[model samples]
Structures are given as C-alpha cells and as structure tokens.
Target: MTTLPASAHWQPALGGDGFVEGIDDIRQAIAIILRTPVGSDPLRPDFGSRVWQYLDWPIDRARPHVVRETVEAIRRWEPRVKVTRVVVALDAEAALKITAYFRLASSGPEISAEVRPK
Candidate 1:
C-alpha cells in the first residue's frame, strides 16, 4: 500500500495558476507576510510585521527592532512554525539581513529563512 503526501496549502506560482506545496508554501507565505507593510491591507490592518518602519534607519539600531517585530508578527500570524530566534544583521555593502530560526509544527524539524522587507 502506498500513502500520498499531504499538502499544507496552495499558493499561486509565478507566471501561472499552478501552486506550490508543503515547505515551499510556508516559505512563500512568510515572505509575503514580511514584505507587506502594516496597515496596507484594510481588511487586515494588523496583518504584517513592523520591519518596514525601520528600513530607512541605521542598521545597528534597526537590527533589534526588526527582530522583535518579525518575531511578534510570526508568532501572531504563522501557526506552522514556532520561532526560536531572530537575527538581524547588515550584509556586505550594508543591505539588511534578517534570518529567522524556527521549528516546524508538524515535523519538528529546525528551519531558517531569510527575509527582506519592502
């Protein structure tokens, strides 16, 4: 007997109507959540993280603030993972880097994702 894999959610794929499954679904979902500015969605005024507010500020100061907001937003919105830690840093040439460490709710495997704010 063969068992089929379970799909968590479906999201539109780039340039088409096809959708992605499983871990990719969560990754894309989280990316969209982080990129959207707070209050941009009238129906969900508090849907996004506050990272955009600090995007123009100095990286040293923005790091902690970004981490805090990202962690809080993830905890509130995304139920698929439990955030372990968030590390915000400035990459070479001063681009902001946000790395989040988390554990999958279903399989308990550790994962990390890099996020960029719009």
Candidate 2:
C-alpha cells in the first residue's frame, strides 16, 4: 500500500519538547491556537483564536462566538484542513469543552480536534 504523505509532515509536540505528525500534529495545532491568548506571541499577534475571551460566559451564550473563533482561527492557520463543524459545551468543572470537526483539503476522512486552555 502507498504510504500517506501526510505522515511526512510534522509539528513540534506540545509541552515536553517533542514532534508530532499526521493527525496528532493537526490536533496539536488546533489546541495551540485555542490555548494561546491573542497578542501573546509578539511576532504573530493574530495567530490565535479569540475564544478565550468568551470562556467566562455561559455555554449557551458563548457557543456561537466560540464556534466562530474556532472556525476562523483554523481557517487562517491550518490551510490543510477545512473546518466543517465546531461543538462547544461546558465541562463538569465549568470549563469550556470545544471540539472542531474538519475534513482534509486533499479529500480524506473527517477528523476532530478537542481544544482546552490547559
């Protein structure tokens, strides 16, 4: 069977200093975008999602904003994937539970990325 070229591309792993490839990289990328507060990166002030601003609001109120930010941020940062849906819910601990569903631009199966500020 032919190996998927997606496996060749990779990104630096979160925390602990390692690298991640394939879907893991994509997942990490989304997590990074959501976790980073805007303007935190001096070189790329607009590189992250604005969802953090709405994290304090009630889930019902924040859902749309969170979805918008998630979609926009992924569209801007990760051109390889086209986000199809974003799900925002409240965690048991009263934290945000965001999940973005997307399909690879190259025409593959849909995938999802769970995002949190941790």
Clash number for each model = 0, 1
- Candidate 2 — which pairs collide? 13-18
Off by over 4 Å in 2: 1-6
lDDT of 1: 0.80
RMSD of each: 3.9, 4.1
C-alpha RMSD between model 1 and the true structure: 3.9
Per-model TM-score, in order, reads 0.84, 0.88
Poorest 10 consecutive residues by lDDT, candidate 2:
1-10
